[model samples]
Target: MTTKNLLVELFVEELPPKALKKLGDAFASVLCEQLRTQGLASASSVATAYASPRRLAAHVTHVRSKAQDQAVLQKLMPVSVGLTADGQATPALLKKLASLGADVSDPAAAVAALKRQGQGKAEALFYDSLVKGVTLDVGLQKALDEAIRQLPIPKVMTYQLDTDCGMPHFLPGWTSVHFVRPAHGLVALHGDTVVPVKALGLTAGNATQGHRFEAAKTPVVIAHADAYAQTLRDDGAVIASFAERRGEIARQLAARAAEVGGGCRPIEDDALLDEVTALVERPNVLVCQFEPEFLEVPQECLILTMKANQKYFPLLDAQGKLTNKFLVVSNISPADPSAVIGGNERVVRPRLADAKFFFDQDRKRPLESRVLGLAKVVYHNKLGSQGERVERVSAIARAIAQQLGGEALARQADQAALLAKADLLTDMVGEFPELQGIMGGYYARHDGLGNDIAEAIEDHYKPRFAGDELPRNPVGVCVALADKLETLVGMFGIGNLPSGDKDPFALRRHALGVVRMLIEKDLPLDLGQILATSAEVFGERVFTSGPMPSETPEGSIGIGSIGVKIDPETIPKVRDFIYDRLSGSLREQGYSAQEVDAVLALRPQRLSEVARRLAAVRTFAALPEAPALAAANKRVGNILKKADAEVQPVVRPELLKEPAETALHAALEQVASVADAAWADGDYTANLKALAALKGPVDAFFDQVMVNADDPALKANRLGLLATLHQAMNRVADLSRLAA
Candidate 1:
């Protein structure tokens, strides 16, 4: 029952930087989980993962040297099959016992000891046995192999090892192994003893190499399981923990940026920080600078090139503008660091020069001229060329703008939509697709287009993700909405709807963008009308022509009309998709399921009014009479649903015989007038609250009246009164959904 911490390490060539963190977490979690499943570790055992450029390791505390033995009961088979009519063991029963490693010499005794348990319609025989515990060496070997197999490797390389000395089936020097990278060493220790585990053709040992060029000792010897981290740090001259290395780099970046003065700091990017941490064991942040003239180019282009091509953090001023100086994380530190700084600066100069060249070359020709080039770029096989998509988007944008404003806004939006995709042909955007809309704005400005058009071109792709900013100007809003609507209607029309987690066309994002624009911007436009207009713009292109007889050859031009006419029935499907996204989004914002269901049940055409109605529903639900009213509303709905014919909402005063029925009819008449006025004025909360005065009359009518009376005329009159009450209460939302 004695326990000690266990340590395991795999030393290999440098791993993929972006996948290193996930790889480390997966390895440690799976190893500890396997041990716990086998009963070698308790629920309280902790696992710590360590990952560096050349290593992946884990240390687990409270792992037992051996698991405890326990009794296991396993159902074998039905009693009818395991026993003969005379109550003797059959050949099949004996064979099953043999497979379980049970003693078959005394089959009759074993069968006698078996217990019967009911399973469905039949009784089954069960076998009980004491399972032996697994030793540390064997358990650790299995866990180690499983951990390596599940490392989340992005890509695998096949290589041959120098020797396969301990491998069971392969000859020495000829065996091949596949891994993220070539494995050179592995270390596994239980306390001070080496656990005999093998992986990637290497036998586990108690020693590993560190920091190829900076380790104090060539082979850092881990004395015991608990000493693994400290020994590696002291002798290896490396920070093995990924988080610790990242923190050190961040501290150094801050210190160096402060030394430069003028409120300068390293640009904030978590992904860049993680990649830098994965690239070095010993981080030395050094400040480097390039010629200040490069600043004339757009800072976005320069910043993106530095971070993507060189993995360097570009410095920025207090005003959030890029500065000339940048920070580079070196893998080693020297007494005089000028050489490393100069080398990094020298390497970055060419990358900056290339970005400047692309920007300059892109500006020579106006963005408007590139519109013709997009015809060669395929947007999708079924959707035809980007040129065709641009035409559809431009038409939709103008229609939306005309509805929102007048001729001026419509003209600006149309021009912006026409030029938005033109940037795809520019040298700058060709090099970096992330800079497409951004570069369009710059190039349009350079071409002497007004600020409205330039800004619209840039902001049309705004709110690309959740919580991202919306377009800043009205023209931009029109184009953004049009762009998203075009995608949604076109895809859904062609039967390309998103299936669980598999939206290749990003239809869900497009739908959410439309919802945000309509609801958050309060655009006062009808979603169904917009979808219909966009579908018309697509015309015959929305239909699928089955599969293409053959794909257009690469670099081929003028591949004529591939799409047929669209199915008109898809318009409602597209509208419903947008509403589904809205429902999910509102629920995620902290509304209860019942509240959301009630508000969304109406499927209001004006999305901007939804929030008002939901607020009104919430306010009404808080009233003292809400439960009784909600229950009465539910009862009324069920009563109307069971009627043989459609019940009219007209209640004749002469037919109201019961005092309770007459009282309820009078109360509804008085309340409905007030609620109707509030609803007409868009005071939804006041309207729903005004209906709360009918709770007493509603409850009393339901308590004293028999809705299904013997006389058909009386029954119809009662149904009419209930229908009138149902309509008044459910104007804002379906209150019955709020009932428990």
Candidate 2:
């Protein structure tokens, strides 16, 4: 079979800008896969995707014109049913042969045609046939049809097709079809030949329209499969390849920014760049400027309006400050671009004016005044209004502040938490919800609040996402921690936990935020104590449902979990949930499972000490005596666990009958005092390292003594000595976890 490059394109009205790249990639990959499945292409075939605002096309190389013929063997029937006593063809054999379209004119010849294979219980008759190969036209039609059916369109559009679309498969009357967009033309070419495929009520042809306005020709003609991209570019006044067009736009943006001088460059945002690339085919980047006074508004507001509303790239100086000038990616290229630049400027003025008006008007009223409006806004049906949530947060903030910074920080935290959600009622935030916290900071400053209060209001939602920065100051830290804890405890108290990928309440994000602040900020706050105090703000009546469901992942986290619902008893589940999240984080940071498990199993109160504890464990595990000590630790634990009664962890020197027990008891006094001193001073590495000195005595005691003595006093004394040894060795981490 001969092979050639293949090209297929769907010409339609403007496609969605954000979904264009995904649609193109999906269409090409699925089409190529179908060809390979049908044996029309090989594994080595290459597929290239091209997507623009008005078209989606794919070019596949090394596609065969026809699949190779195949040899097939099929089981007919048992040998007994096909052959009789005289070896003549049975009536069932003749009927089965006729159904298969096999030659059945002579019974004897047909019987001889099938081969017999004898087996123990049953022998079967097999028929062999040569199946003809499939032509490329038939294969591509199937592939094209399958490709259209499987496109990951964000939304489907239904439209009526008329005779003008030249759909050969349809009559002269109108027909309705559904697709991502309305199709006006379809092109499918195999080498130099046109593939007569039908899709979306349109027939495939070699001609397609390009660049609705500035194309050099009405209908661009592709002569061959390999010439599709080049011809479309030369004759259609469009850049068919999406990547090529995006690169050109970026190059033009950089060049134009340099031309503006003062070390200007366009803001870096890949999502914005991709959307602009999809909106134009042949990009002509032109510089445009807005009023210099509009920069009075926050640069976030200005930059957001330009990128989100106008689809323009705002320029910034070397200092990363927004300039009065921005760039536009126009689809048309004219001899003179002054008209385009002026038109863009005129269009953006009203947008900036609206923002400035909102800003100026918002400053007239204080953020504290807006606090009352939050009473009417619903946060959750089960959980009260946003106003109620604010009160809870304020209380939690005060409690946390008193613990960390006393009355001074508590006052600032209370003020910030009180007005943190106030911006949600602002005019600017109403227009763009993304500016919720940002608007509050500006308004707080306008109301004569101190920088501490203003900064805290702005950063109360800090570390909102993974790798996001934490709050800047101590006051900000207090409010931020309070805000996240309130959301977590409130949601979990309501039995609204995240199930699978469906985190409608964003509980996972909120939980992760708490962990980040606790660990990264190195705040010496106890997670359990804070969570308990936070839950107390809601009172005992806050829980309105039952236990967490067994199906939720929360059930598996160390605490007792039943079916998920709101209940007062479920409050303890938060500790397990937070620690579960921490364990995963530690593993991601390159700590071994044994290392993480050993340190976290003890549930240390201070998160700041966790890193130090892990470092200490790593250093101790590298010691030459660590293996024997770890194994001995495991044995001691088992012995203590199997004690007939609770063997008190007290060693009686008077009851020490054996030399090994005497030596071990002496070693604990010498080594354990030092380990305890180091642990008390937060020197965890020294604490664990001090245990390595006792390995020799530990091995001697285990080798020479039997823990289960016939006399209860001897057994108790041996057990107590081992208990003292266990306590000393595991002060930093559970050494038994290190055992294989």
Best by TM-score: 1
Error of 2 at 70 (Å): 4.3
* lDDT, candidates in the order shown: 0.89, 0.87
User: What does the lDDT read for residue 336 in candidate 2?
Assistant: 96
List TM-score per model, in order.
0.92, 0.88
> Per-residue CA lDDT of candidate 1, range 194-256, in tens?
988888888899999888888999899999989987888899988989989999999999999
Where in model 2 is the C-alpha error above 4 Å? 70-133, 164-175, 540-568, 624-648, 653-670, 693-726, 735-740
lDDT of 2 at 487: 84
For model 1 the local lDDT of residue 482 reads 93
Q: Number of the top candidate by lDDT? A: 1
Clashes of each: 0, 10
RMSD per prediction, one decimal? 3.5, 6.5
